[model samples]
Target: MSENNRYTLITGGTEGIGLELSRLFAKDKHNLIIVARNKERLEKVKKEVEKEFNIVARILSIDLSVNNSCEEIYRFVEKNNFVVDNLINNAGIGSFGSFHELDMEKEEKLIEINIRSLTKLTNYFLKKMIDEKTGGILNVASTAAFLAGPKMNIYYASKAYVLSLTEAIHEEVKDYGIRVSCLCPGAVQTAFQNKAGIMKNDKTKGLMMSPKEVARIAYRDFKKGKVIIIPGFKNKLLVLGNKLASRSLGRKIVMHSNKSK
Candidate 1:
């Protein structure tokens, strides 16, 4: 596909790694469609991207946590005649306390957004890309995916699913010339900490990385079709350690770190 005809569609693109990825894509002169629940922030980002890269930036404001969100997004894309060349399933949520302690509604919303919606959107776009014979997919998982997190159980499980799903799809679509990458970033510095209610502990802050650095690494690794892209050296070691450590030991470490604050 010609560069002019291709456009990237990024979810949760108003902030964090998603926003940084949008900026990177814009720098490469690719048209962009950024989806987020915040219309105002999305508009602001669109303007900034257009100003900086001289590329078209389309905004779609919709809550991915809603049950029917995937269908709604699909319909909107069909109605607007937007063809996506790259799909970034970056929207997700996390709960900080014990799963049972959190409100049931909040827990369900987290699952809907982080798992169901991501899967639906990937399936939707993957079909289209397969038919077109060219495209890419990047799903944002987390280092939490490598182990069972005690305090953030549901979020960790959801990301584990993302990593598994992305890897499976990567193998399935390799022959279609479509690259699929799962990004497993550790403790990124963004609104995620506040949203996830992660305690303001020294360990968390010390391990935190800038969203721009994570995005840059993810984008580079993704383009090269890396199956799993962990952004930092520390994170890479953590992932490797998870593989070598006993499952019980890994879970204990996660629980300790989470409760340190």
Candidate 2:
């Protein structure tokens, strides 16, 4: 793809850090393809981005949690003859409470969206990027990826997979000039907490950060080709502490936080 036509495709781009990242890229003059399940919200975001940045903004509405969703998205792009220069896998869902107590259907959907679908989409885009030999991928993970999250077990595990997968792919594709970065952010003040049932806890509230702050740090690190972008100094310290802390102690800390929720 020529520099003039380069496009960045961001999943879950209607709100939160995904939306903020879209704004940043739009300001940089990259044509955008923003995906979200809500057509109304997507269209609103599309108009706002177009008006503010004076760039083309495309909205793709699809529930990424559904099986074969990634394939469908790939088909849509191919049918439209769209070429992506950047792929941002930012769509994910979280479930709180004991694993057995959570709704089985919801848990399955979380896995489908947070893990399976993200992986599939990354693979699909990475292949295209490798063929072009010039593109980037950003996978949004979480600080929860570093340790076992007792109440949010599946979500944490899914993020761990994202972090690990991105690192592995970064190593594999560096020679090809393809950049892959995993953004591991701590608590961000987004609808995510409310959706995940995390907003009820005081502990989580204490750790909360604004979505824009996280996006700024993440975007900087991503452009610098950092493989792991952990936003905020405190979050960085926590990740480092977790790595050095004893497994039993770390598990205890994680479980203790869950007890309040």
TM-score of each: 0.96, 0.96
Q: What ranges in model 2 sit over 4 Å off?
A: 1-5, 201-206
What are the runs in model 1 whose C-alpha is more than 4 Å off? 1-5
Strongest candidate by lDDT = 1
Collision count of model 2: 0
Per-residue lDDT of model 2, residues 1-261, tens digit only: 223456799999889999999999888888898989999999999888888888888888999888778888898888878889899999888888888788989988998888888888889989999999999999999998888888888989999999999999999999999989999999888998788777585665657778899999888889999999999999999999999998789879988977777
User: In terms of TM-score, how similar is model 1 to the real structure?
Assistant: 0.96
Clashes of 1: 0
For residues 1-261, could you state the per-residue lDDT of candidate 1 as single tens digits?
123546799999989889999999989888998889998999999999998899988888899887787888788778878788899999888888886688889889999999998899999999999999999999999999999999999989999999999999999999999999999999888888888778665555766899999999999999999999999999999999999999999999999978875
In angstroms, how far off is 106's CA in candidate 1?
0.4
How far out, in Å, is residue 12 in model 2? 0.4
Local error of candidate 2 at residue 38 (angstroms): 0.9
The 0-to-1 C-alpha lDDT of every candidate, in the order given, reads 0.90, 0.88
Error of 1 at 234 (Å): 0.6
